[model samples]
Target: MTMRAWVIKQYGKPEDLVLDRIPVPSLREGGAEPVDTLVKIEAVGLNFADEIAIAGRYQDRIEPPFVPGNEFAGTVVQTSGSSRFQIGDRVACQVRSGAFAEYCAVPSHRLMAIGDLPAPIAAALPVSYTTAHVALFQKANLTAGQTILIHAAAGGLGIAATQLARSAGARIIATAGSEDKRRIARENGAEHVIDYRQPDWHDEVKALAPQGVDIILDPVGGQTSERSLRLLGWRGQLLVCGFASGEIPALKANYMLVKSASVHGVYWSFDRNPEEIATIQQDLVGRCADGKISPLIQQVRPISELIEAIKDLGTRNTVGKVVLAW
Candidate 1:
C-alpha cells in the first residue's frame, strides 16, 4: 500500500525535505524477526539532532533521499511475532532514524505502551528522558542533596534533566536564554533561574551554590563549557551532553587537574543490548503514566508543516519539545 512520508532528497536545510508517497514495508518473508514491530505513526518528535542529521553533521551520518526522525508514537498495526505486544497496541519508541513517515518498523524491545497519554507527549519521552537519566545517574553519579547547574534549562534536554535531578532531591539552578524560558524552568522544579545572556550569569550561579555546584549538566557547549568549569567544586563533574551552540568547546587538561575535577562526554546513542534499552523505556513510561514527568511541548505542528517546525527548532525559537503530529 502507498503511504505518505517526508523524504530528504539532500542534506542542507529543513526546507530541503520533500513530502512524497512511498510504499508501505511488509514483514520479512516467511516470518518477521522476533524483535521487529510495525507501527502506524501518529506523532513524531523533533530534536536538535534532527537538524544536525539533515545537515550531515551528526556523528552517525545519513545518506540523502532518507527519512529524518528518531522518536515516534503510534499504534501497532502488525506484530513481528513478539508475544510481548499485539496488534492495535498503543506504543512509543526511539530508533536510529527513519521516523518521519506514516509508519515505522521499530524493534519490539524499544516499544513501550503509552497508556492514556497523548501520542505527541509519548513521542517526546524516549530520547530526552533516557539521555537525562544516563547522563545524571550513570555518567555523572549524581547524588541526593547535591547542587546541579542545568544549562539551557528550558529546552527539551534541559527540561528532562531538571525534572530528573529535582526528583533525585538535588538543588536545581537553571539557566535559560530568556525570561519566558526561565519562567518555564522555574515551573519545572528549578530552584533558581538565570538568563545566560547576561555578562555576570556565572556570578549569579556562584552566589546561589556558594562553594560550587556538585554536578553541571551542559548541552550548550561554547563559552558555557568554559564558565561551567569555574562553578564546579573540588572533584565536581561536568557532563557534556551536546554542542547546541554550533561552536564546539574544549577543556584544558591542566585546568581539570588544577581543580581536581572531571569532564565527561555523554553520548546517549551508544550501542546496547535491546533488553537494556527496553528497561530504560519501561522506567520512563512508568514515570509518565504516574505524572511524575510531563513533557513540556512547545508546539505541535501538522505533518504538512514539518519543514516549518524544523526551521523553528533550528532558529532556537522554541522553548521545549516540538512535535509533528499526524
Candidate 2:
C-alpha cells in the first residue's frame, strides 16, 4: 500500500519538503528490530524546530530523504506483536521524525493515549506542553503566588507556559512581538502583556513585578537572556529553553554569585522516560477537557499544503501552533 508524506529531499528551505507517495511502513518486529506501531495520522504539529531542521541549522543530524515532523496524533491501525497498543486506539506522540505523513510507524513506547480529545489538540500537545511542564514544574519548581515572565508569549511554547503557570497560580507577565499577540497572550491567562519589540518592554515587566519575577521562561535567547537575569529575584531561575532569536546569550558567573540566581537549561526531550511522558500527556488531556488549559491552534490546513504551512510558521507571523490535518 502507498501513503503520502512530506519528504525532505535536500536541506534548504521550507519548499524543499517534497510531497511523495511512499510505501506504508511494515509492522515487523523481532530481536534487534524496532517495535513499530502503525498509525493513520489525523493531524501533524508544526514547530519552529521544523524550520531549523529543514534548513540544516539544528544541532541534531538529519539525512535527506527523511520526514521532518516531531509530533502527531492519529488512530492506531496495526501493531507489532511486542506492542501493547491495540488497533483503533486514539493516540498522540513525538518521534524523531516521520510525522509529516498520512501514516507513521512510531515506536510503541512513545505512544500516548489521547482519550476523547480531537486530533488537532492532541497533535499540538506533546512537544510544547511537555517543554513547559518540565521547565516550570520539574526544573524551576515554580510555586503558587510567584511571578513568571514568559518570553515570546504568543508563540507555541510561550502560550503553553502561560497557561501552565496560570494553572499553578503564578502571576504571569507575557511578552509578545505585537499587539495582536499581546491580546492573545492575555486571553490565554496572562495577567500582564508587554510588546517585547518595544525598547521599554522590560520596564513594564519591572513595574508589574516589583520584587522581581521568581522565574523567567526564555525561548528567545539573544539579548533577552541577559536581560531576563536582571528581572530575577534572589535565588530565582532563568530557564533556558531555546535560542529562537538566532543568537545564544552568554552570562557571567559573577553576576549569579551576587544575585544568588541560577540559570537552568531545559531540554525536554533529553533523558525522558516514556512512562513519564504518558503521565504528562494524560494530565494535559485532562486539563484541556476541563478547560483549565487549551491547545492554541492558529491555523489548520490540509496535508497537501504542508510546505506553505511550514513557510507561514517560519515567518513567525502566526500565533500559537500550526497544524496540518490529513
Q: Write the residue-wise lDDT of candidate 2 on 1-326 in tens digits.
A: 99988888988898778889999887767655365799999999998888899888887868887888999999999987778789999999888888998998877877888879899999999899989999999899999999899999988999999999998999998899878999999999999888888898888988998778889999999899988888888888999999888889987776688879999999866334666767787788788878888988967889888888887776787799888898
TM-score list, all predictions:
0.96, 0.95
The global Cα lDDT (0 to 1) of model 2 is 0.87
Name the lDDT value of residue 88 in candidate 1: 85
Model 1, residue 129: C-alpha shift (Å): 0.8
The window of 10 residues in a row where model 2 has the poorest summed lDDT is: 268-277
**Which residue segments of model 1 deviate by more than 4 Å?**
29-35
Candidate 1 clashing pairs, residues 3+ apart or interchain: none
Q: For model 1, how does the per-residue alpha-carbon lDDT over 248-293 read when each residue is reduced to its tens digit?
A: 8877676688779999998765255556667777898899889899
Model 2: residue 85 alpha-carbon error in angstroms:
1.6
Report residue 265 deviation for candidate 1 (angstroms).
Answer: 1.2
Whole-structure CA lDDT of model 1: 0.87
Error of 2 at 15 (Å): 1.4
Give the poorly placed runs of model 2, Cα more than 4 Å off.
Answer: 31-33, 270-272
Model 2 alpha-carbon miss at residue 146, Å? 0.6
